[model samples]
Target: MRKRERENPCGVCGHYHKYEEGEVCETCGHRMLATSEKASVHFSAFPSEILPQFLYLGSYDNASRSELLKTQGISRVLNTVPACQNLYKNSFTYHCLQDDKSLSFDDANQFLENCERDKARVLVHCMSGKSRSPAIVIAYLMKSKGWRLERSHQWVKERRPSIDLAEGTLVH
Candidate 1:
């Protein structure tokens, strides 16, 4: 229903089109209209109420992890993976233990405290973006929202249908 973005140059690759018929980007293979639609709809994901100034990028998947970091407006990135801490430390703002299976509430609180102090928009990343990272996010939500851990997890699940907290992670 909408027209393609042949007129606008691609921001990612910076290539222009030759004519009105040319809707796709000239340089990159990406579709112009789709990119514009995504840009327009992205702000809807972060609602003003429950949405944290912080983001939870979640575990070690290449796509979600990279997208979270490369997102348009992000202030801080926290790589919660211990194994790859040294690799991404210089690139990111914080690198805490990636203790996914056994995430302690204290650690979550401490991380949130740091975020509050810095006034930064934090993105918590792990590997799969499912279990480990969601657990920490759940912990944070529970602490901040005063909801039971299970309820907090449910709330996040509503927004991110794919999320599944690691086993035994629901207990506070």
Candidate 2:
């Protein structure tokens, strides 16, 4: 620990900050709080199980929950965004998609399919469990279950009610 760290540590995430670091702690993406304030956690930190023990869908925060993932039997992860860091490479098998576009749907589905074949549980996630991650899960259903777009979507929606797809991401 550095001398500055010994002096002032972030109140919320407990990460030590240098004098130049200012208000927010870059380590945990949390802003420093005043003495009276308390830190809060995002509810979306836990992934929603989409398939009986085989698949889950959630946000980047969900992907970071290593111990929780292990408890849920998730041995692999399929990250839908390129920018989101893979928090536990050693703990879980991961395939980070380079981008999130319609063209990338096939690749995401292929990864999901492989995990299913191997009987491995995987968590598919983007920045939020809302749009990108759900889209990937929907695509996987279409290919694996012979379901049409609407049916596949409804299936995923039934499981995770929080999924809010952007208008442009939805097919007519």
Best by lDDT: 2
TM-score of each: 0.56, 0.74
List pairs with backbone clashes in candidate 2: none
Off by over 4 Å in 1: 1-50, 62-70, 85-88, 98-101
- Backbone clashes in candidate 2 total 0
Residue 53, candidate 1: alpha-carbon lDDT:
55
Per-residue lDDT of candidate 2, residues 69-139 (tens digit): 89889999998777567878889999988853543988888898899999999999876577888988988
Residue 55, candidate 2: Cα error in Å is 1.1
lDDT of 2: 0.76
Q: Report backbone clashes per prediction.
A: 9, 0
Cα deviation at 120, candidate 2, in Å, is 0.2
lDDT of each: 0.53, 0.76
